[model samples]
Structure formats: structure tokens, C-alpha cells
Target: MRIMTYNVHVWYDNDGQFKLQEMIDLIKLLKPDLLCLQEITKHGLTEFVKQTGFTKVFKYHSVAILTNIENVEELSPPSNTRNYYPRFATVKVPLGDGKEFFLTCVHLDYKVETNRMKEIKQIKKHLSCLNADAAQVWAGDFNALTLEDYSDVVLNEITSVRRKNNWEMPKNDVSTTMKADGFECSWALVDRPPPVSTCRFDTHIDYIYINQDFRKIFEVTKVEHHGSTASDHSPVIADFKLIQTDDTEEESGDQ
Candidate 1:
């Protein structure tokens, strides 16, 4: 499966031109099965769906999902009031093998750390309720560059203070959604030269994550920072092979 996460800067490329059609053209060319978009205005989302013939789920402020596959199921929004402004959406897509996985597209608050922390907690709470027996992925712009111990947020609840040695998990690393407990970042697993900065205008943010089970099945074939003329943030593309699993295998394999 090929998935892409892009902060389209509201459809305006780095050239300071606002052309939604150009963005649509790019997406059409890539034909990603799943797309996680940030900073997409309602109008742009509508236009994208109209142009690309892909179904889409649009949150209020900075997150959206577009997919060509059928059977998209929407998950409940986070309960945290801190993020009244929509920042994420959880959607389920069919894997074409009688199996389905949840794909969560997120764009956390960049201005407020307190609010960001609240959002993270809310996301974890929501994940905890998922059918842990199925494959799941959370991908998008986290606005978190450092890789401090998220165990507290995911496991305990202790928040505050920065940890040394926890260089912000690189954008590519965090982008590959991994399980909170035993999963490792895809970028960390493979050795690669420095990533071309995704955020040429500001900061490099945006990501994708897949739990361990899915990782074993699908390898991250590529993670490229598509230089942007359409947004302040560049797009990250990840290609993977849908490792065929025997239907008879344990139902509760990965979540």
C-alpha cells in the first residue's frame, strides 16, 4: 500500500501561488491508496474529492483523509476539549483480503504545548479503545520533533520536562505509526542519510506510524520528502507491500 502525508499549506505552493488543481494533479499522479492531509480548508477538501474521485473525511482545522478504496469507517473524535478545533480523524479502510485497518490522520496543535499534550492523551485514550486484534496506523503532522519518552503519556500519564538523548524522533521515524508498547520507528530501523528538510519554510513536522504486526508484513519501501511549492511543509510518501497473511492465522495478530 502506498500512503502519503502532506501539509498542503492550504493548497498554496512555495511559489506563493494558490492552485488547488495543481495539488489535485499531484495526488492523482501518485494515486496513493491513503492520503493524510494537513491544513486543508473545507473548500480545498471538497475540490480534491471532486477532482480525484476519492472519498474524503474532513476535520475542522488542519486534518483530512482521502482514499480511493471503499468501506471507509469514521472513528469518534477525541474527547479532550482542548482541541475543539478539529485536528484528527480515524478512518477504517478495507485491505482487500477480508481484513480492515484503521488509519488515523492527525495534526496536533503547534502553538500550545499544554494543548498538544492534551491532544496526545486524547489520542492514546482513543487508541486504547480500538479492536486491538486488528492492524492499525496513525499518521500525520504531530508537531512533535523530539523523541522523549511517550510511555508516560501512552502508559502512565506523567507529563512535563524534556528528556536528554531523546532527539526529536525524526519526522520519518514518527511518521510510520508503530505500536505504543513494542513497535519501533521505521526510519530508525533502516539506515539512511539525513532527510531533506520537509519544512523548508518553517519546521519539519508530519509523520506516519504502523504497529509492529503490520511492519512485519509490509516494508517501508520509501520515505521521500517531496519538495513543496504547494505548502509550507513538504509531503512524505511511504510505499509498502501488503504482505499476504494466511487468513487462518491468529485473528488477534496486530492492532
Candidate 2:
């Protein structure tokens, strides 16, 4: 399966012009089986969902999950929030042959680290409530960087940037997430360095993460950037292979 995550910056081209056809063309080139987008407008998504090749689509806040297959729906119940758009979404994705995984696509609060952390917790809690054993493929614009992304002293750069921006590093939250079992960034799977910039911010912050239980079940064969000028942030395209049944089920059978 090919999976991708892109922050379309509200579906405008880098020059700040509306680019529905351009965006559509870019997605076609990526040819992702699963795609996640952030910072898109409601009208933009509604239009994209209509024309994009993906047969199933779901959007919440400014985030969207697009898949080539059908039977995609929210993993958790919808919330009645008082915002112009929904802010979070997780979809039950069909992976073929009676298999599936939950893909959570989110555009976290960019202004406050604390707010983003709170939302992340709420998203995880929602997933747990829906299906405690659910496998996850998390992707989005995290809006924060980690100190342990396997880049030497690039670790220091994360802290330095946080200090420069005068935002307190959400240490406890970052540790909790990175330390979670079955949770690994897709970049770490391959030997190449991570993207230099995920968006026009000149920093890399977008990502795709798979939980521990699902990591062994899928193989991330390629992770690379797509369409340099399509959006402010470059879309990350990943080719993955699911080699086995869910580890949880396989283990239960072994016992």
C-alpha cells in the first residue's frame, strides 16, 4: 500500500492561488492507497472528496483521510465542537482480505503546544474507546519536533528551535508518544535523512507513524517527498507492504 501525508495549507498553491486541478493532479501522481491532509478548508475537502480518485473520504476539523477503497468511516463517534471546522478524524480503513487498521489524521492546534498535546491525548482516548485492540497508522502535521528522531545533534536543533520560538517543549507528551510500543516514525525505517522542510516554515514536522503491533505486520519500503511546488509543505509518499495478519491476532492464535 502507498500512504501519504500532506498539509495542503488550505489547498492553495505556493503562489497563494487556488489550485484544485493542480492539487488533484499531484495526488494522482502520488498514487497513494491512503492519504492524509491537514489545514484544508471545508469547501476544499468537499470538492476534493468529490473528484479525487479515492472512493472513500472522511474529514474532521481541517484534516482528511482519503483511501482508494471503500468502507471507510470514522473510527470514533463524531464530536459537536464549536469551531468552523472539525479538528480531528480517525477512519476504519479496509486493507483488503478481511484486514483493517485505524488511520488518525489530525491538524493539531498550531498556536499552543499544550493545546496540541491535549488534543493528541483526546484522540488516543477516543481510539481506545472505539477498539482497544485497533491497529493504527497515524499521519499529520504534528507542528512540533522531537529530540529523538535518530538524527545526531539534530536533536539539539529541536530544542534550539523551540527556544528560539519561545515555546516550552512538551517534554512529557513527546516522551510518552515516542516511547509507546508499536509506534515508530516511517522515516526511521529507511536509512535516508528526513526531509529538510515539511512546509514553507523551513522545518520538517509532518509524518507517518505506525504502532508497534502493526509495525511488523507492514513493511515501509519507500519514504520520499512528492511534488515540490504543489503545496507549501511537501507531501510524503510511503510505499508499505502488509506481510501478515495483525500481530495481536496472530499472537492470540499462537497461544
Candidate 3:
């Protein structure tokens, strides 16, 4: 499976140039089976669905998903959380031969670690409702740093900037929290070096994560930053290969 997650930066480039067609061209070249997009406007979404010729498109607020695959089932995020629609969206994609998996696309809080933390807490609550053995993936721009991406000096410098803004220092608890919950970052699992930056900030923040059940069935072939001048944030791609037969055990859990 070829899955991609991209933040279109509101259909503009980092230099403030409008490049919607360029962005479409990039997606055309890659032709991901499943694509999750963030920071897209209503007009941009219409243009993409029309030009890309994707059979299915789902949008909740600014985040949208495009896929050519058939029989894809849309799923809902927890409504109990405040303003959850824009921040989270989900779908169930059939893997054929009666197998399937759940995909939750997300764009977490861009500023304030506390806000991001609250979002993560809600996400954790949502995931806990799913079956323990179900294959699941969450991917998007997290807008938070991972501890592994920076040296102590660079990390401290970032912390200092937040301090000057009267913001609490970043403890990198988001990454740690997800890890503690058994979600594995696909980028870290791959043996390749990541791009210098996934966004204009020169930091790697966008990510793809698969749960233990997913790891049991597929091997991650590659994860890369698909470079583009169309958006401030680069698209992230992950390729997976089926390595083993899926377990057919039936389990009951919330969607």
C-alpha cells in the first residue's frame, strides 16, 4: 500500500506564492492509493477532487482525504472532544480477501504544547475504544518535535524561544505519550535518514504511525519526505508490503 500525508499550507508556498496546480501535479506524479491532506480550503478541495480523479473524498473542516480505492468506509472521531472535526478524520480501507484496517488522519494543534497535549489525550481515548488486535494507522502534521530529531543544544535553543514567549518548555511528551501507548513511528522504524525538515521550520514534525497489529501483517518498505515547492510542508510517504497472513480472529470494540 502506498499512503501519503501532506499539509498544503493553505494552497500556498512558503514564499507566499499560490501554486495549487503545482501541488496537484506533485500528487499526480506520486498517485498514492491513500492520501490525507491538511490546511486545505473548500475551493482547493474541490479542485483537487476534480483534477486528481480520486473516486472518494472525505473532508471535515480543512483536512481532506482522497483515494481511488473502492469500498472505503468513512469513520468518525470522538465528538466528545471540543472542535474535533477539523483536527481528526478517519476511514476504513478494505485490504481485500476480507481483510481491512482503520486509518485516522490528524492535524494536531500548531501552537502551545498544552493544547497539543490535550488533543493527544483525546486521541488516546479514542484509540483505546478500538479492538486491541485491529490494524490501525494515524498520520499527519503533528506540529510538535520528536526527541530523536534534535541534539541537546538544538533542543535547548528551541526551548529558549518558547521561554521568551512565556510558554512552558517542551518536554516532548506527545511523542513519548504515543510511544507509551504502543504506536510506532514509521519514520523511526525505517533505516533511512529523514529530510532536514518536513516543514519550513527546519524540523521534522509530520509523522506516520502504525499499531502493533499492523506491524504483524506488513513490513514498512520506505518512508520519505516527498519534496515539493508547492507547500511549506512536504508530503510524507510510506510504502508497505504484506509479509504474513492476517489473523482472522473476531474481536468486538468501538469504531
Clashing pairs in 3: none
Q: What is the lDDT of every predicted structure here? A: 0.66, 0.72, 0.82
Best by TM-score: 3
Q: Candidate 2 on 20-60: residue-level lDDT in tens?
A: 67888778776788889888888878778777757777766
Q: How do the residues 8-54 of candidate 1 rate in per-residue lDDT, one tens digit apiece?
A: 88888767889788888888888888899888888878888888888
Q: What is the TM-score of each candidate against the true structure?
A: 0.75, 0.81, 0.88
Model 3, span 161-224: residue lDDT tens: 8789776566688888778878888988985465747987677789888888888777899999
Among these predictions, the greatest lDDT belongs to 3
> Model 1, stretches more than 4 Å misplaced?
56-61, 79-84, 96-98, 112-114, 147-180, 201-203, 246-255
Give the TM-score comparing model 2 with the true structure, all chains together: 0.81
Ranking 2 against 3 by TM-score, winner: 3
lDDT of 1 at 93: 77
lDDT of 3: 0.82
